[model samples]
Target: MPADDSPTGLSQPLYLCVADELGQLIAQGQLAAGERLPSVRELSQRRGLSPTTALAALRALEQRGWVEARPQSGYYVRPKLRRLAEPATSRPPSAARPVTVGSIAARLLAASNEPGIIGFGAAIPEADWYPVATLQRLASQAARRHRLLIGEYSPFFGLPALRHQIARRYAELGIAVDDDEVVITNGCMEAINLALRTVAAPGAVIAVESPTYYGLLQLIEAQGMQALEIPTHARDGLSVEALATALTGPQGAQIRACVVTPAFCNPIGALMPEAAREALVALCRQHRIALIEDDVYGELDFAGQRPLPARYWDRSGNVLLCGSFSKSLAPGARIGWLLAGRHRDAVRMRKFTTSAGTALVYQHALSAYLETQAYPRHLVRLRRLCATNVARYIEAIERYFPAGTRVTRPSGGFVVWVELPRGTDTLALYERALFRRINFAPGPLFSASGRYRNCLRLNAGRQWTPDVDGALQALGRLVEAG
Candidate 1:
């Protein structure tokens, strides 16, 4: 390892400094794969540090996947091909493509829900993350105290109390939406569906992030609208330049709406920088294209401060922002809310035609829950846990996956995008993993044109236990062998 010359008066802890030194050595090829790494005892003795600090440093590297510990054999440099690089920013064909969401997602979704598998497929938080006991208590309270609410159907705009709470949350994100402008839906899916239907019609083109949430593409396909996928980057999301080019081109007039997840987008977990977000909103406004913002994962940022959604940049109210408590709160509550802005009447009518309104029971429950400080407290814990899991998962992937397997470094949310060696078929790997009782989201599912055949998305939403780690390691082995 490089000499740990602790830079003069740094804020980083000693163990972290050690970890950084070791990481540098590995990256610089000073330490070769499969070679035995320094033991905790050696690290302590050589660095002249306490054993605890040395162990912690080694463990940090372990979590980052620099080295792996063998039960009795000590630590060794993990063997990897290191030949592949992270997937480049996507560049989908310019023209619109008719949606053809295959039947593959059905099988994967089914597998994700079924027992007997170590799941890394579904973008759901760990079960423990939800305040189940609290929700149960609230549910009973809501049933007893709000009997009248259940007896009558919810108002077209949804329960005023829930809308107010949803609006307050939006206010925190810098969108000053009135409670009356909010419409409650069964989940984020429904909110997005309503937004798509309101701004677009059959055969119209809807622009989306190239490798976006599969569910979004599924929604567009179900509505019979074509998709024009805009190129997006893994770290910074949705390319405003490409979008501008697409919107001003001859085919721009056909585009009815643009759907985007500016905060921790699914599959890739990319965040759109503030400038890009502003540019996108302005572009949409200039082109008169309606913008639908998915902020479902907005508040789960590890940094705690929420990123401003495109709605914050909207002056004409053309941006409809969608948020759901499903990922952060109880999924069973099925509580999602939308601020439709100018399209309020259209969304209100669609809500009536579809499920009428979000269930009063769920609305009341979530509303009551949000009134307490528990929601924010739960979010803090959930974010910390998810971040740690992501770090540990990255380490595991480094230790076990082949070299050249590029993975996303997400700042928030619990999904990581991994690009494997070229020609490595993730669909085939999916089948092999299912046979081994492991499930992960294959890359092709997220695209309209079936790209990313060598990529896969791993869910870090689950608690990082031995079983989860084992399954991830097995997945790496499978990719390497293939």
Candidate 2:
């Protein structure tokens, strides 16, 4: 039997104590691979540690690839931890996998129903705040005229009217694109996927911002592409110097593309400065690399002037601009488009094979909605609401979280990044919060290498309801108790 010594009296921190115990259990073969471990709550209760401490321990184990977490259910030893393969030069044949919407729905629904839980987790706008009535009117009008078109297949690129609207919108951003340059996809996610597929083969090396949107990391992993994380700043987006170093250095030449979110990036709402943006475009040009710009949150900026995307500086047509109405409008609409620039024809063909085309009816509806003067007015109001809510969230976080808790002051976007005091495990906090009828996204999810264990991103888009305050207090209590 393993030593039964109490976790107390260890010279290390309490979280370390918990982690050491788990490590010992695994070493003793008492916790074998695929074996279910105690739930975060059960472990906390058994060890007399706060739930936060228990979660930190588990997250540490998770980072080491020793465990896996299933939604709703407790933690279990991973069946196998797959190591990221080294970068390769060739493409692999496509393999078909079952698309499971159920898993995604379960996670979203579970997160939605948590009592006393402030939903700072999803990137979605609050349900009541979006312009639902306007969309309804637009949809009705579109159906009145395009009833026949709804039953037919949309062109592989997209509905012509929608593409024209997209191109016109890009003109305002200083990106000179015509209707043919735009390719509609299910959402910005698919736009990005198609862009990556068009430019690079599987197992190819691609550069991505550190602490990028978790969805992007998942996409890279799914495509069997290896990502080299370029160090980025909280205030200025991706560091051009770091990127230049990566590009000119040994790893730079092999990188097929660089993916960035230039404006109001997810997790970190950094907007690249104009000079930095120029430099980035120049760097990509110098290195002959493709720059895939994810600008999903560009329209949500509430601070200074909304900076144009890096695509504006793409004189060489190396930049692919991917954007969507998912964040600005309702996510269910799933209307997203891409300006593939030089890769237009390649992307068009990929779009033909992959989902055929985005829903034509939604595209027409959104196009009509965009033509109205109300769209920009609605966006202005939405930005103000997000800014106000984010300010309140910062105040609440300051009041409740312990000293030394570092929170990001994002100029725009609905998410906030909180850096907890070192050694705090957010995943542990997540598990504990679940029991308290709260849910949050843990930090490690945003990293490709499973780093950032002490960091957590909160969705500040929702209103500061009483339940939200209570949840913040609860989270604070968990941190302090640890």
Candidate 3:
């Protein structure tokens, strides 16, 4: 029962070590399903540990689906259940097609935030998930203390204090980020936009995931660039081999940059393996293509360890790391930052000339909040909540969705990608779902070539409730009918 006792004890806590060992045994078939686990005291005695440690390990196992608790009967390996299939790796066309999507896409998004809609459509974390009350109080305090600076413009790179905090957080993630080089923007999208405009020209080609965030595709389309879709896995993220192939193909020479989420990519919620990240950086460095990383979802990891960003391997400054509080902290704060390795000066200049700067009040408020609560501490609790929500959503999907429906299980983030049975048209379902007052992202919107006709993405950012549960059940019926 020592204070040092952790769950699993693998990495995050001592209990994780215990949970990991048990999970491995179960996966290896050594601990057969339905077999009984040791009693808390027996586990402690057998493993030369304390009772608390044993109990904690068992609890971690239960949380991760390795075991189940049966009241006074002790823990038992959970019965193996047939889960929904995962989506297959994407194989988008190799040609780099010019962006043609326009304002209609914008009009569809315009009604996304409308009230009275049961929203599972947007990628944003629900307002109920954030520490909004605390943020509002902090904003009020910042406004009172810096009343004179209320209407003042933030520095060209944002408030020094906020930049300092952002830099500190990046350092924790193993990026040697320079605060001076960081350019703050309206949000992650703006940071990405600025980085894109800074590196590639309007007509240049950019390599992107076959199925990526709609916002990213929209940006590519809005910038008048051509998109060379690279094959991507539903769980493993962008394929480096595919990207290399694209880089060497007839259209490869036209590709100036490769934009990716790297960690929990939107729509698919995929994370590139550490080795893949290194390779991606090397590929970009060798080919002289810029690596634009969208790290907004980086902090939402369900696993305790945050994936190392592609920015960590950028030795030649070919990487542009974009981050924001929109995904992790305040949604409306609109505070985003970018670290452009060699293009720092140009990005800063471009951003300055275009937008001047972000609001000082929010900058100061965020800086103060981060200083007081150290983002890491908040993330720990947030991650645990998100993990639980993801589990609930997955349970609902497995129980209610059609038998042939496939889904994604991400290591981090709150979004899940669903691939319906072949010939199922989600666009038609989108209309029906809307009519029924349930909102979810239709698959076609996530692509430029209008692919993913039967795919859909759902947001699990909101806490599970009875109403949501009913909505999911109803959606299941809707999908079945489709």
Candidate 4:
């Protein structure tokens, strides 16, 4: 073991810092596979840490799949997971088209909850993955603390404390924001909706990443707006050059807004690079287009650092930054927020008319949770679990799926986009898989043009289990039979 440094002035927990350092060593091949790790006692003595902290670091490593423990033996470096080639960049039609995603999304959601079904459909985190007990306790405490206000409607934007916490997080990203500028929403769904309503008029064209989140498509469809699907990379995220072409061409005049998930986009899990993000912000600003950023998955980066959102470069106030705690915390809490730069008032109006305000209890509870260091600690564990589970899913797909199956190597988030061989209709595959009590997101739901017929999005949020493995094998067999 190398000499450890003092943990003063660290950004995250001391144990997390130690674990990250050790994990990097393992990643860099300094700690070969199957090599025994230093015992907790020795590690503590050498690093001048307490036994509890040293053991916690090792346990964190175990959770993140950096090392494993054996009976009467200390932790040992685990073998690296196999990586598959990522899917190619998407090529949806350049022209803006009306979104018409039907009831498939709802059907998938319903099927995902059915008994006997192995759900790999919805992007929701597994229930057990959350700090349910802690959240519940906080909720109870909030109820007692704000009992008089529980029956009354919350403030138009939200509780001040929660908004301040949200603002504090953005400040960490180097974005200056006032707590009063934040508006609470039902979830990222409503935040996007509010942003859309505030920025674009009905029947206007909204640009989006090809094979984008179906929820965004549905929102566009519901608002009677047209979506111009831009070509998107499976790894590098929204192609700024492709978008630039669209914005400068004949249809450029028609574009009113661009909705993007820059970090760990759903379905595809693409992390737009910092350069791309800056260019995107500049492009949107140049074209006078509203850039609505859905940053719900921003905190789930596997690399332990949150990528700066496209909003980070917006000086003209054209960027509407949206985020939610659903992915990193409790989804049922339904707590989401928006930092609508120039359209703050408009968004507030939209939010007031649409949902009045978010539930006060959740806002209070989440605020209380944020006041403690528990949220950061919980996020550390959540990110590790998500990284491990995503790797497991990719490995299983490589081992079980048909040949020519390509999966995204997401650096963050809990979903992977899988592209099977051409002529493989995943909708058809999904029908059969459901018949066998298996559920996964069919790719057609991801596009306004109903593209990606051979592709599908797998939820890698669940822990590895025999049932999940068996389901994957069965799904592979079904694909083969076709």
Candidates in order have lDDT scores of 0.83, 0.75, 0.82, 0.86
Model 3, poorest ten-residue lDDT window?
A: 1-10
Task: Indicate whether candidate 2 or candidate 4 has the larger TM-score.
Answer: 4
TM-score of each: 0.85, 0.76, 0.85, 0.86
What tens digits encode model 4's per-residue C-alpha lDDT throughout 1-482?
A: 10111123233477876776676567546788999999999999999999999999999888766689998988999886544578889999878999888698888878888998888998977776777767787788888888756678789899999999999988988999999889988999999999998889899999999889999999999999999999999889999999999998888999999999999998899999999999999999998999999999999998799898888898988999999999988899999999999898888888889989888888888888888887777778778768767766776787678887898989899998999988999999999999999899999999999899999999988656668878988998888787
User: Taking the tens digit of each residue's C-alpha lDDT, what string does model 3 give over 1-482?
Assistant: 11111222112455655665566567445788899998999989988888898999999778656689998899999876657889889988878887654553564576576777778888876674566666777788888998677566557778998998889988987778878987888999999999999999988999999798878888888899988888999888999999998898898788999999999999898999989999999999999999999999988888778888899988899999998999887889999999999999899898988899888888887888888654666677567656666766776787788889999988789998889888889888888888888888888887878899999888888655567878898999999987
- Candidate 4 wrong stretches, greater than 4 Å: 1-83
Q: List the candidate 3 regions with Cα displacement exceeding 4 Å.
A: 1-81, 101-104
Q: On residues 172-260, what C-alpha lDDT tens digit does candidate 2 reach at each position?
A: 87778988888888999999999999988887778877677878877877788877777767767788887887777776657889899
Best by TM-score: 4
Task: Return the TM-score for candidate 3, rounded to 2 decimals.
Answer: 0.85
Each prediction's RMSD to truth: 7.6, 18.0, 6.1, 6.3
Winner by lDDT? 4
What local lDDT score does residue 82 receive in model 4, on the 0 to 100 scale?
47
lDDT of 1: 0.83
Give the alpha carbon lDDT tens digit for every residue of 345-393 in model 1.
9888988998877678777777888887777777776676566667656
Q: RMSD of candidate 3 to the true fold?
A: 6.1
